[model samples]
Target: MKNVLFIAVFLCSSFLRAQEGTNMKRVIVPPEIVKLAFEKEYPGKTPVWSEEYVGDDNDEIRYEAKYDVNKTTKALAIYDNLGNLKAYEMQISLSQLPPKAQSYLKKNYPAKAIKEIAVVVDDKNKTTYEVGIEKDSRFYDVVFDKNGGFDVIIEKN
Candidate 1:
């Protein structure tokens, strides 16, 4: 469900536009309203920014903010052009996973080293945990419900 968002809002508060024809991406400078919104929401923190198109016509853009939440935790917060928070993802330690999730990983993916662990909270406030691991050189994302029940698995290559 790759719903994680938030990262790319401040490294350069400039707009990036893809050149119409060739394979090159053009970097253009423009007023970034999203950066203003982000600053208001998260004062004292500068974030890296990226733009994404959403909606039926792909005409809407969302801004994502990526930054370190703490010395050990990396976090992302996604927002709409209007500054509405769309989702959040935060890195966490394995011990933070629910006990059932921990057991499931140990039993089903024994001896496999975990690559990443994170928790995602959507605009609706629904939460889920995502665990990344590698097997046979293929990376996978295992998603679990907030309570530790299995949700789904996605092959991420």
Candidate 2:
């Protein structure tokens, strides 16, 4: 169930008529609106930004910002053209993941190394964690609910 939205959003974000690719170009200063919004929402935090123009027209551009929320937590925030905060992804340590998610990993992929644990925050602030790991030269992303319930598994060749 969650896989559908995850795949759909990823597909929509990856492809757009105006963009040949979803390359993230680093910018010293983001758009004025994006700067203002980020400042207002997250004061005192330094931000590094990257932007990609999505969709088919001028109105469809999107701006993304990456910054360190703490020494151990990295944040990736996406803003709309108007600078409205759309969503953000937070990278957390394996120990920070839900207990069930951790246990599942230990039992199922004990021999494989755990990579990254990322929490996706949607517009309404709903969150999901995606754990990235590689095995046998193939990468897999396993997502879980906040309570550590299994969600979806995606393989990358």
Question: For each candidate, what is the lDDT?
Answer: 0.64, 0.68
lDDT top scorer: 2
lDDT of 1 by residue, 25-90 (tens): 233222367677667867888676656666557676666676677777677777777678777777
Shift in Å, residue 28, candidate 2: 6.1
> What are the clash counts of all predictions, listed in order?
10, 0
For model 1, the stretches where C-alpha displacement exceeds 4 angstroms are 1-33, 54-60
Candidate 1, residue 40: Cα displacement in angstroms equals 3.3
Off by over 4 Å in 2: 1-28, 53-59
Q: For model 2, give the 10-residue run with minimal summed lDDT.
A: 11-20
Q: In model 1, what are the clashing residue pairs, if there are any? A: 6-65, 6-77, 7-64, 7-65, 7-66, 8-48, 8-49, 8-50, 9-48, 9-49
Candidate 2 residue pairs in backbone clash: none
